[model samples]
Each structure stands twice: as structure tokens, then as C-alpha cells.
Target: MGKWLGMCAVVAAAVLTSGAASAQSGFPSKPVHIYVPYSAGGAVDILARTLGEVVSKQWGQGVVIENRPGAGGVVASQALAGSAPDGHTLIVVASGHATNPFLYEKLPYDTFKDFTPITLLASSPNILLVKADSPFKTLADMIAQARAKPGSLAFGHAGNGTSTHLAGELLKGLAKIDINAIPYKGGVPAINDLLGGQIPMSFNNGPESVGQLQAGAVRALAVTTASRASFLPDVPSMAETVPGYDTEVWWGLLGPAGMPADLVEKLAHDFVAALNTDQMKARLTKLGASPIGSTPQQFDQKIHADYEKWGPIIKAAGMKAE
Candidate 1:
């Protein structure tokens, strides 16, 4: 009886090992779906499509990008949470993903518990921009003016919980200046308003602001990163004026919770491989984004860090959404 039991145990172990290998090897048995929590043509959607193209080629499978923009990402996140943990369904979330829990009164899914982070695909700094003809040539100049007339200066941002809005708030807190924040439906509208002279300045992501900057239609006062962006080296970093100010718009890949460890690892490896390719590198640089392609563990840590860092700020600002 003892020998029979030992043989059964050995067979069971072999079957388990084979099952794990099969799961990893047979991913994307059908078309893979990646959900973008924003509208098409936006940075997140662009990045997803760009990366998906490379990943699909690598996997010999079709990648479908679905845009489900609403509630600052809740709509898509809810869909992801309800998906099977087989790695077929995934999402590309932005920096707002970390702060959404704090922005909304109640979320449809738990931020940390409902998903498995696959990798941080890329990051880009937000730029403080004004029309080319505006008088604020530098970040210091803008701060000086805001100090001179408290609340007289206002800056447009994509939305209340977006990275651009947070960048403006960080500037206000660190620069010790009073500036009103004007929320727009999206970044393009904010940039349009700035260009139309309706708003004096706006906070926009690197991807969206690069065109205007290159056209000389807008002047970038500072990039909201600890250091200057490689693509916009001429622009000063906000840290140069407001020491310690650092924030960025980052996007990461995630699947629904309960993904098997081996499957998660396989997905991360494939995605990171795609990100490291020369084609992806050039594409990301043109988009004004820096590719990260961090491991699952690293992505999880970043998400937690951002969640902790932004929760208090959101609370203090009294930012809440229905």
C-alpha cells in the first residue's frame, strides 16, 4: 500500500508540472483582448496599439484593443476584474489608476486585490505649457507671477484626477503659490484653450505636447519630472524651481486577479521582450515616452507607492467623483 501511494504521488507531481508548462506555452489560444481605459488616439491607446502590434507578431496571434473610456478608468477596470484569470484579457492603465480609489467615493473593484500587474510599459513627464507668445518664459517667472497675485493665475488640466491636474497641484504646494486649476474634458481641449488664449497655461503630457512644442506654438516652462526629459532637454525640470517635485504619466499592463504564477511570468517576459525591441524603442521615443517594462513584482510596488503618495493629496484637495 505504501509503494502504491508513492507511485501515485510521483504521477501527480509530473502531471502538475506538465500542466504548468502547457498553460504558459499555449497562451493566446485565440485572439487576445487588451482594454484601454481611455479614448482612441490618446496616449494610452496609442501605446497599447503600438505595443500590441509587436506582441502580436511575437505570439503569432491577433491582439484586439478595446476602448472603454469612462469614470477615469473604472469602467474598463471593472470589466478586467470580472475577466477570467487565464491571461487572455488585460488592461493598460495610466497613472490615474493608482489614484482612482481615492478620487471615487466607492470603486467597483478593489484597486490592489482585483488585478495582477504584468509590467509597467512606459512613462512620460507632464509639461507646464503656455502659448509661445505668453510672457512666462520660465517656471520661475510663472511662480513669481502667481505669488504676486494669488489665485489670479489659472492653469488648465485634463481632468481632476489626472496626472496633469496633480502636476499643477504639486506645483502649487511646492512653489507656495495660489493658482486656480481649470479642469477640461481632455488634454487636447486644454491645449486648445491655451492656444486660443482662453487659458494662459496648461499642464499636458509629453506625448500630447510634443507637436505644439516642435511647431513653436507653445512654450514649455518646465517638465514635471525630477530631471529634464530627454526629448525636451531644453525645457527645465520642475524640480529645478520647486525642489523635490516629481510626477509622471505612466502606463502598465495588468490582468485580472488570480492569474497563475507561471502564466504571469510568461506574459511579463513576452511583453518586456517586445518593449526592448529596437522598433518599440524608436516608437516610444517618438511618442515622448520612456519604456520601463518592469517585472510584475516591480509594477506592483510602483502601484502601491503611487497609491500611498496620491491618496493623501487627493484627500487634502477634497477631490471626489460620483
Candidate 2:
């Protein structure tokens, strides 16, 4: 009887190991769902749909993009956190994902603990823009005016805790200037106000500002990156005046926590592969974004780094979500 029981135990162990292997190798056994935490036609939604199309073709599985826009991405984030650890469910998150914990008093899920980083998909620089006829021809002109008048100069941004808002704040901190930050419901409204002369300047992402730039309705004073953006080569970087300034609107992929390491690796490999295609590269460039298919480890590090980098800035700025 003892010999028979030992043999049965060994057989069960082998079966369990084989099942695990099969599960890992057969990722997305069903249709994959990608939740976008913003409204359609937005940058995050566009990115999700664009990538989903390529990934679906590669995996031979349907990729569904569900937009759950609200509460600074908490709604969709909570949904992702509750999903199975299998690679079938994922979310495309923005840079705001890293700063939400600091902006809100409470979140439904833990930022780092509730998700597995898949990859950093793409990024676009924020442009400090003014009307073409505005007096601020250069970043230095804006900084000088801010210093001369103190709080008299103001810049508009998409919303509180957004990448554009943070870009403006980072400028204030590094330049030691007091420029009031005005928040709008969306980037469109902010840019509209800038053009209408309701705001002197606005910080907008590359996609949001590109049309106005090409039409010559708006002028780019500086891009909020350490170096000049490839899409707007003529625009100088903020770091030219404030040596340490750097910020951009970035997006990445994440899945529910507790995903198997091998599954994460598989998802990362497939998604990175999809992102590297010539089609995806050209599409991203048209949207004024640069494709960045970073490894899981690198994406995780970015989240942690941004979390640390923005916590104090959010707190110091006294920003909170309504």
C-alpha cells in the first residue's frame, strides 16, 4: 500500500507541473481585454486601440478596448486589480498612474502592489505654448516675465495632477518663479483658452499642440523634456534655461498583480514585438509620440521613480482630486 501511494503522489506532482506549463504557454486562451482609463479619442484610448489591433493580429485573438474613464483612472485600475492574474486582462495607463496615489487621499487599489508592469509603450513631450502673436517668444522671455511680475504670469494645463500640470510645476520649481497654474477640464479647453487670450500660456502634450503648431496658430516656447523633441526640433528644451527640468506624457501597459513570471515575460515579449513593427512606429510618430517598448523590469523602475519624483511635488502644490 505504501509503494502504491508514493507512485500516485509522484504522478499528481507531474500532472500539476504540466498543467502549470500549459497555462503559461497558452496565454490569452480567450479574447484579451484592455481597459483604457479615459474617454475615447484621447491619447490613452488611441494608444490602446492602436496596440490592440497589432497584438490581436499577432496573437490570433480578439483584443477588446474598454474605456472606463473616471476618478483619475481609479475606476479602471480597480477593475484591473480584481481581474485574474492570467495575461488576458490588461490596462494601458498614463504617467498619471504613478502620481495618483499622491494626489488622492485614498485609492481603491495600491499603485505598485496591485499591478504587474508589462512595458512602457510610448511617450510625448509637453510643449509650453503661446499664441503665435504672444509676447513670450522664448522660454527665457516667459521666465523673465514671471520673475518681473511674480504671480502675475499664469499658465493653463489640462487638469490637476496631469502630466501637463506637473510640467508647469516642475518649471516653477526649477526656475524659481511664481507662475500661477490654471487647470482646465481637458487639454482642448486649455488650448482654446490660450488661443482666445484667456490664458497667457499653456502646457500641452505633443499631440494636443501639434495641429495648432502646424497651422501657425500657436507657437512652441519650449518643450518640457531634457532635450528637444524629435517632432518639434525647432522648439528648445526647458532644460536649456532651467538645467534640471524634464517631464513628458508617457503611457505603459500593466496587468493584475500576482501574474506568473513566465506569463509576464510572454506578454512583454509579444507586446514589445507588436510595438516594434514598422506600422506601429509610423503610426506613433504621426501621433507625435515616440515608441518605447521597455522591459518589464524597466517599466517597473519607471513607475517607482515617478512615484518618488512626483509625491513631493504633488504635496507641495497642494493638489487633490475632487
Candidate 3:
């Protein structure tokens, strides 16, 4: 009787240990949902969808993409902030996320307090584009015209606080020009008007403008990045014309706050692995974006840094929410 009791006790302990291990390791029992703050085909959306395909395949579960574009990502961000911290739902946001606090009077969720940083996925320069037949042939000609007639020229952007908009504001300050900033609901609508000749020029993400640029439908005046874009080698950077000018839209992944550290590590590792793949690199290269698979801490630091860096600029510009 004693021997039987001892063997039964050992079996129970083994079962308990196995159960604990399974519980601790188990994650993603359901499909993953990635929320993109921008419209479809935009850089952020593309990154989410591309990564979703690979991640879903790896996990053998569906990775759904939900596009909730509005108010410079406020809508999607609010939804994400309200979601559970199960690591199954995530939000892919752009550089605008960092500047949102300064742009808005109040946010539904605390930027850092309500979210967990996953990784910085990629970064791309915003290109200043004009209709292929516009009279402004070079960056100099465009700047000269703007300087000559302040407020006469109008440029369209995705939204008031978006990276696209900030790039324009930065240019306005550096170039000391007074071109009007027109805010659109998203990049596609802005591009629509830009192509239709309703606006003199507009800022577009690298991927958003690549097709038009390659097809000769629009002419790139200058890139917003400090350096010239590799894809548009002939086009000069705004920094070339205006010293100290630099801006690039970046995309990163984040989840609801309070996710398990182990789960966060697992998710980050898988996504970083995907980002390092040759397939992912080639796709991003074609879109004129550079892939960055940074650690969670690195991404978190970038968020804080940008939030600090742009607060002064947004406040000085007196930018208000749209």
C-alpha cells in the first residue's frame, strides 16, 4: 500500500509540472489581429499585411488586418488601447504616434501607459511630388516660387499631425516660406487631388509615390530625409536646399499594456526574424523603405525620443487637432 501511494504521488507531481509548463508556454490560442492606423496600400498598412502573411503562415492561424484610418490614427489607437493584453491584438503605427500627444488636446489612451512597444518595423522618407508637367522643375524653382508668393502655394498632407504634415511644417520653418498646409483624410485622397491639379504639390510616402514616380506621372522635387533616397538617386534631398532638414516616417508594432514579458519576447523575436528575411528586405527595398527590426526597449526609446523632440515643434507651430 505504501509503494502504491508513493508511485501515485510521483505521477500527480509530474502531471502538475507538465500542466504548469504548458500553461506558461501557451500563447496565441486564437487568430492574431493587426490594426493599421493608415489606409490600405500605405506604408504602415503594407508592413502589417506583409508581416501578417508570414506570421500567420508560421503559426498556422489567420492574421487579420483591420484598417481604421481617421483623425491621424486616433480611431485605431483608441480601439487598440481598449483591447485586452493577450498579445493577440496589435497596432501598427507610424511616426505620427509619437507626435500625437502634442497635436491633440487629449488622447483617449496614454501613449506609453496603455501600450507595450514591440519593435520598429521600418522607416521611409517622405517625397515631395508635383504633377509631372508642373512648371517647378527643381527644388530651387519650387522654393523660389514659394518664397516669392508666400501663402499662394498650397501643399496637401495626410493629416494635421501626421509625419507627412510635420515634414511640411519643418520645411516651412527651415525654408522660411509660407505655403499653406492642406490636411487630407489620408494619403490616397491627397494624392487624388495632387494628380488632379487641385494642389500645387504634396508629400507622399516612398511606397505611395513610387508607382507614380516610376511611371512619370509625378515629379519628385526632393526627399524629406537628410540623405537622398536610394531609389530616387537623382532627386535632391530637402536638406541639400535647406540645412538641418531631416524627417522620415517610421512604422512600428505595439500591443496593449501589461502583456506577459515572455509572450512579448516571443512575438518580438518572431517578427524580427521575419523582418530579417531576404523576402521581407526585397519587398521593403522596392517600396523605398529600410527595414528595422529593433528590440522592444530600442523601439520604446525611439517613441519617447520622438515624443520629446516633436513636442516643441508642434507647440511652437501652434498645431491643433483636426
The clash numbers for all candidates, in the given order, read 0, 0, 0
Q: Tens digits of per-residue lDDT for model 1 on 1-322?
A: 1122224334333333333344466787999999999999988898899889999998899999999989999999999999999989999999889999888888989999999998877888899999999998888888898999998999999988889988988888888999999999889999999999999999999899999999999999999888888888888889888988988989999999999988987787778778778988898888888877666777898899999988888888887753
**How many residue pairs clash in model 1?**
0
Q: What lDDT does the true structure give each of the candidates?
A: 0.86, 0.86, 0.83
Ranking by lDDT: 1, 2, 3
TM-score, per-candidate, Cα-based: 0.92, 0.92, 0.86
In terms of lDDT, model 3 sits at 0.83
Better of 2 and 3 by TM-score: 2
Off by over 4 Å in 1: 1-23
Q: Please provide, for model 2 over 1-322, each residue's C-alpha lDDT reduced to its tens digit, 9 standing for 90 to 100.
A: 1122224334333322332343376667899999999999988898899999998998889999999999889999999999999888999999999999988888999999999998777888999999999988898988898899999989999999999999999999999999999999989999999999999999999888888999999999998878888888888888888998888888999999999888877777777777777888887887888877666787898899999999999999999975
Number of residue pairs clashing in candidate 3, backbone atoms closer than 3 angstroms, sequence gap of 3 or more or interchain: 0
Using alpha carbons, what is the TM-score of model 3? 0.86
lDDT of 3 by residue, 20-63 (tens): 23233656788999999877876777788889988887678889
Candidate 2: segments with Cα more than 4 A from true spot? 1-23
When summed lDDT is taken over every stretch of 10 residues in candidate 1, the lowest stretch is: 1-10
What is the C-alpha local distance difference test score of candidate 1? 0.86
The RMSD of every model to the true structure, in order and in angstroms, is 9.6, 10.5, 11.8
